[model samples]
Target: MKRIKLALIPYSAYALIFIVAPILLILLYSFQDSSGSFTLENYARFFDLSDPVYLKVLWRSIKLAVISTVICLILGYPMAYILSRLPARIRGTVSFLFILPMWMNFLLRTYSWMSLLERTGLINSLIGWFNGILPSALQLPTLDIMYTQWAVVLGNVYNFLPFMILPIYTVLIKIDKSLIEAAQDLGASRGRVFRKVIFPLSLSGVVSGISMTFMPAVTTFVISRLLGGGQNALIGDMIENQFKVVGDWGFGSAMSVILMVLILLTMNVIQRYESENSGGSVLM
Candidate 1:
């Protein structure tokens, strides 16, 4: 017990310096004005019903994050299922393929996406080439969706799909084969088995995946900046601008606190829902 306590000291100190300290500073700065006096004006500006620009940004962030997370779940769930069902011999290879891109620098990955999504980028250039051979009526329209909300969504889905996939896949692969076999023996159809047994058991993974994907999607400034062309500013972008460009640490910290609170609330709701659902399903 003494050794364990001593061992934890290093990690506890690391957490204090890196995590607790930063949160404390942000909390402190959040209530202070530029003059270093305490005030509620920062939060008031965020919740101002009259202006509501910041509120709109917050809404947009949630909206985009929801869309991205839903898309990931829709796409990832099936991919994870398939990966889990794959033959054990080749599963590692295929999973590696999914994980390969993540090994690259995140900035490089986003930049690569930017290149691909650009007006005259590789995708459009290929389309133009294909159009050159086709009749005028058969030519494809030039792609022009760059620097839009859709672009941001695309970036989010591309980057975060793996996060959704890996967690669900981990859970799916760990599901007991006997349960599936018993369901099969009990005359449950494939779809019914998946719906009744597989999905219920995998709820924890889905919850984790949703939390992981949604948090980053909501708070991402780089994807919005690179793909949104600064037109569709998210709460993240606003917070970044407040601190970096506007030199308003107080407002930035306030926004950060609000965003943090909103995230914590969302995660708590999800966790509570997961507990209730998982318990009920297991009981049934």
Candidate 2:
């Protein structure tokens, strides 16, 4: 009990000084006006859908996050499944390779895409070589994938793929081989086995992956800024602008609160669905 108390004391102090204090400050500021009078005007501004700019930015952020999450799942699931099936000796090395890029600064990784996607970028140069094989009119347009929604999605997927893979791989590794064999013995096809057994059993991992990828993707400013340009700016950019450009701490805090609430609501809905579906499963 004494050791536990001592351990918790440091954590409690850290939480108070870092998490709790900053959140409390934000909350306090969120309710105050420019004149320092307490008010809900900041939050009220968020619900004014008549301001198409805010609504559009919020929608774009949610859409981008959702699309990126889906892309991560589609790409990561198969990769994770293959990785899970590999020999234990190679799994660690493979996992390391997947995560090695994450050790680099995120800004550097994002910036690297610029060189690969520019008009005279590596991709465009390669395409130009191919275009020489055809008439100028018949040649395909030079790859201009930079500063588009695709760039933002690709950036998100590259950064968050590891988050999706790790969780799904962890869950897949623990899945019972005997259960899979039993399903096969019962005349289940490969698709059926995957859809009914493997997928259902992996809901916890899916939840973890989705939460990890989606939450960060929505709030990420650097990737969209560096890749999507200001044109594809998300709600994160809006909140950033409010604080940095408009010098409106109240509105920024309110935006932060709204984002927090939206994340909470999304997670709750997903958790409830996962719980319902895994109701009778022993795995969870």
Candidate 3:
């Protein structure tokens, strides 16, 4: 145990320098105004509601993030199951296919989708093609969702679905075969087995995937900026603008601090739920 503690010293130092120091700096800067004197005004601006723009942006961020996380869950859970059931020979290949996109730059991956979704883009062209092939009443109209909330959600789901898949896949593959066999021997249908056994076992992974997906989805400025145009600016965009464009570091830091607290609170809720469920699972 002492040797293990000694091995952790380097990582502890690294976190202290890189993580703790930066957070302390952000906290210090968040409480200060233009004159560098400490005041509550920086935080007050966010919650003041007299001008509710920031509050609305934060809410929009949450809404879009929730949508993205839900979509990923719907898609990823099935994908993870399919991947987990694949034969070992092909499973690795399929998993690699999922991971291959990550090798590209994140911005580049997001920007690629713009071409597919934009006006005069492939989707619109495909719709136009369908229109040509069908009667007027049956024609598909051109999609105009570019630079909109839908586009933002699409962008988020595309980028973060893998985060959802990987964790659930990790947990699903680790499930004991005997437990599943025993459930089957008891005459549980596929749905019942999943509901009572597999799902309960995989709750930890689902919670982890939700956390991973929602955090990046909420805090992402790049996808929103590239796909949402300037109209659908999220809280992240607001923070970036404050620091980079508006030169209001104090307010930006305040927003960052708020984002951190919100994420931590969300994580805490998820962990608490996991703990309660885990205890009940053991009891069962």
Which candidate model has the greater lDDT, 1 or 3? 3
The deviation in Å at residue 77 for candidate 3 is 0.6
The numbered model that scores best in lDDT is 3
- Residue 10 in candidate 2 has what lDDT? 87
The sequence of per-residue lDDT tens digits that candidate 2 reaches over residues 123-242 is 899888989898877888887889999999999998999999999999999999999999999999999999989988998898889999999999998899999987999989988899
The TM-score of predicted model 3 comes to 0.94
Put down candidate 1 lDDT per residue, 1-284, tens digits, no spaces.
78778988899999999999999999999999999999999999999999999999999999999999999999999999999999999988999999999999887888788788789898999999999999998999888788999999999999999999999999999999999999999999999999988998998999999999999999999999988897999999999999889999999999999999999999999999999988898678
Root-mean-square deviation of each candidate, in angstroms? 1.7, 2.2, 2.0
Q: In candidate 3, which residue pairs get closer than 3 Å at backbone N, Cα or C atoms, i.e. clash?
A: none
Off by over 4 Å in 2: 2-7, 134-139
Query: What order do candidates take by lDDT, descending?
Result: 3, 1, 2
Give the TM-score comparing model 2 with the true structure, all chains together.
0.92
lDDT of 3 by residue, 1-284 (tens): 78888998899999999999999999999999899998999899999878998999999999999999999999999999999999989988999999999999999989989889989998899999889989988977789999999999999999999999999999999999899999999999999999999999999999999999999999999999999999999999999999889999999999999999999999999999989998999998
- Per-model TM against the reference: 0.94, 0.92, 0.94
- Tell me the lDDT of candidate 1: 0.94
Instruction: Give the lDDT of residue 207 in candidate 2.
Output: 89
**Number of the candidate with higher TM-score, 2 or 3:** 3
